[model samples]
Target: MNKHFYQKCIASALALIMFFSLFAGANPAKAEAALNINADGAILVDGETGKVLYEKNADSVLGIASMTKMMTEYILLDAVKKGKVKWDQEYTPSDLVYKISQNRDLSNVPLRADGKYNVRELYDAMAIYSANAATIAIAEIIGGSETNFVKMMNEKAGKLGLKDFKFVNSSGLNNRDYKGEQPQGTGAEDENVMSARAVAKLAFHLINDFPDVLKTASTPKKTFREGTEDRIEMINWNWMLPELDYGYQGMDGLKTGTTDFAGYCFTGTAGRDGKRFITVVQNAKDSSGKGGYKARFDETRKMMDYAFSNYSKEKIVPKHYQVKGQKTIPVIKGKENEVKIYTKSAINMIVHNGDEKNYQPVLVLDKKKINKDGKLTAPIKKGEKVGYVTVKPKNGEKVSFLTGEDQIQVDVIAAQDVEKANWFVLMMRGVGNFFGDVWHGIASTVKGWFK
Candidate 1:
């Protein structure tokens, strides 16, 4: 029996290997973080459409650990955007930042006192190494104290329209007061947590808002000095940076973070053929001294592999192309008449081997099933919703995403369906209602009058 069990195990392993080898890129396995990645929240999206491809507990609120620095970089970049600071701007570690670094917090690039560091040096240090000191210096240099810097972080979060997120610290570290105790939910606290989806969205906005950061964050390794101080060499913490051929070398600039509470989190992007994909994974196990980090990297590679393998930007339907009949639908009691819908999302689909024109399509709408009459009942105004479609492949799950198909809402007031209210049509409806009302009214009136 033991021998048989061994044989089965060996056969299973072989089968798994063969499966991977055969179906390497067939369809992206619903992106579940692989073994060792016990992260509770995660998301994967196409960089082009910003459409989420897969998510698990994405909006779930959880501590983000040091991943908070991504926001720090964003705020600093905003300053640069406002011309408040130049790329070569000289920023010095303030007395406040120096003290924080002296405490030797979770992650810091210790800056020596009596020395000045440029913005570029600090940016690279924090970006490549997740240095605690580097982050504090940036906080102090940007906003006088990490406290003020943290407020700036919240402002940026607000600007990003982050609904499920709040900023308490410039770093992902837990908030601590002067006594080295955790602060309880007040004033730029470090207890800020966000869902995986929110973090991904934040990362996506950063990429869109500041594409330049990647040039440094994506570096495999770099060495730099601050004001002629000892040179610090730092390497990226994202393990995925080296494993995949296409995603690795071309990939640039992002943040990696980990803490006992937040596990490991990484947000990064890579481009091929001018098409880029931004990926966010949180709570990934990062036992660096152990072998857990590799699994996280492997999972990222798998997601990227699936995205590039299956999706390529293709225009499924041209703008203003009549899909069914009309452009808009009527929606009563809604903000607008008929809601106009169109797919601004470029259908990123992969087609091969004579399967070009064989794509079968179906549309679906946001409104619930309607049976008011055989068709949509009146009251739908211009810009009111109707339905959507499912664009199915010949062999697989239907593709329900199209630019104009899903948004085929009716333009209620675009033209009057009344069509001069044909006398015959009005008479039939009026007669049906009049007889029903006459009988009910007589019964009610007789009962009331008798009483």
Candidate 2:
């Protein structure tokens, strides 16, 4: 090869190497390490933002056990809010609920065959004690039948954007546990199932949309039918409550589940020092393969520890901040040739401590407002939303939100107005552009002839 050709080739190779190096810099120095959560599926997320901080087999479908009540709770709360039901409304036990309630082997706050219970009492039993019969009773009240309630559950799951879920019953029990009287639409052997991620999403919405649910969920114990002979002391199944033995500080208001098919599962939430986290551990087990109530809480504790110890709500992108290379965009036919742009609001999310430096802001402009040359034509208004800015890890590791929504972002807006140029100025510019194009065409032809 000639010397000039070899030089060009070396220069091209160097350019390619530099280009790859720039992208490679965005990758983390090491692969994302797992939390080693001992469960069939597990996930951890910031309670307020719903930003997923960690996950393990989080998308895998598995039995949810009594954690299924969270959905039932959600629906019932929605019904109450819409005035479709009232806390003082009375309920008469159905044949199925009576039979299930009498089964002392399962979780229950036994109901008298002829007893009349109100909505608030039934909800207390269902939420705190994981009472299967009470859950069914509430389901019946809202949907007119447990079968219809299951449909509502599935439909609501779809509306919530839940992925990997199936609701066969209001209570998270294997249908066979009901003998031949399972809810109308479900198979005899079917059980409620949800991915850890979906369960977290359910819990997220439950707490956010109906914050009052936490008031009852956090109750360590409550009396069902207090002052009546049928009254029962309903102890919460969630051992992590502040008044419980394994109680972690700031722990409160969540659900726990256990069944032969589902093993042990818990959807837990805790808040401390102005930060809150939601965690899900499904089918948790120990090294000996023994799964039980303690195992689920233990796994959840590990996740919470990881979250509280390592992650915190940090303002990764500040309001009015400008991206390094995208501080402004070109404008056409405007008094100003360019308009400055910045984030409309600050973006705060759960992030690992010391890892904030790895995130970089990326500007995404709205294509409808910009022309082919990537220039916006005036007149632009101040604070107009021109696009949005999202942040991503430099290491290319995927960061997901619990709701399966887009990553948290801030609006990218014009910082000031860019008025359209005067008519005379526009005409003058048009003439100048026409002459400039003609001169460029002539110059190109002459240059090609010389070549």
Candidate 3:
């Protein structure tokens, strides 16, 4: 080949390779395989930040089964904390609780017709054993009746920012299980329902707002009415407990649910190496399409494994970090024309490995503190919060927090003080601006004439 031809060929080949490399970089290989979660609905979230790490059909409302009790637990705990109810206060079993507690078909710790169980005892049975009757007794103590408790559940769900949920009863049982004696405000066939996202949110708040609940939830075995003739062994249904046959390390205080309608469902939380995750699996099944206790835990384990192996809590945006082109805001009538601003705290979020660069910070200033042009008034104090900063994916991938409203955020504050200019200085500046505007107008007119 001629020398010139050889040179041209080499350049063409180089160009082709560069083009392909750019194309490949633009559309990088998929980071990892989609999690193989076997469930109708599922979600995995960082326990600390509520950042959703993985999800499948998480918004579709489905039967929550006994997971509904987490809400009841939240309310009861709040009541106890606020002095609305006492742990030592005793509750007399009503006819409904008495009858339901005796039913062997349901998960119950058989209550005596004349029994006066304390709130603490009933709470243990409900939290550890998923005792339906015990749950109802606690609900009655708080809401005065199961019907009222259902209202409280829905109300609290709204306040907690849970989007998809319906509470027909304090216990998660289908209303039909009530045998026509269901709570008054619900339909005969209605069952407690919530989306996987909402379930995870509930679990998140349950553990965070009331960490003590885990102590009771982790109990594998407790005797109801211990030392009494009516005492019965209550074994926790959560097989993932560290003491159980299918135990997983770091597993603690969570709930499990199963029903013909809801199949097998679980809301599980585990922590390892200072990182914790909350996972929810609804209608979980095995390879053979079989739903069982083990199936729920298996599916949950899959998600948990995917999270711990592939993701980590990273300080995506460091404290005092300033956003480009937004590091300062113009100050009106100040010693300095502008004030430097930076994040008040670091933004730590759960992120997939290799995806850290995908996120960017967004600044939203407080409207009341700034003018329409985003200029701040004079006399701004150092470290004063002017707005907030939230993180969003640069690639536009949807990022959802456990609570719909809980986007990971930190405060944006002024980095330095901006004192107001003296009145004489302000007056002189105003005169200068007026003259400058007059001169600029005259110059513009002259330029127009030339044009």
Return the number of clashes found in candidate 2.
Answer: 3
Most lDDT-accurate candidate:
2
TM-score, per-candidate, Cα-based = 0.63, 0.86, 0.90
Instruction: Provide the lowest-lDDT 10-residue window in model 3.
Output: 23-32
lDDT of 3 by residue, 62-106 (tens): 998888889999999999999999999998899999999999899
> By TM-score, how accurate is candidate 2?
0.86
- Candidate 2: misplaced stretches above 4 Å? 1-35, 439-451
Ranking by TM-score: 3, 2, 1
How high is the CA lDDT of each candidate model?
A: 0.61, 0.89, 0.87
Sort every candidate by lDDT, greatest first: 2, 3, 1
Q: Evaluated with TM-score, which candidate comes out highest?
A: 3
Where does candidate 2 clash, by residue pair?
26-394, 27-395, 28-395
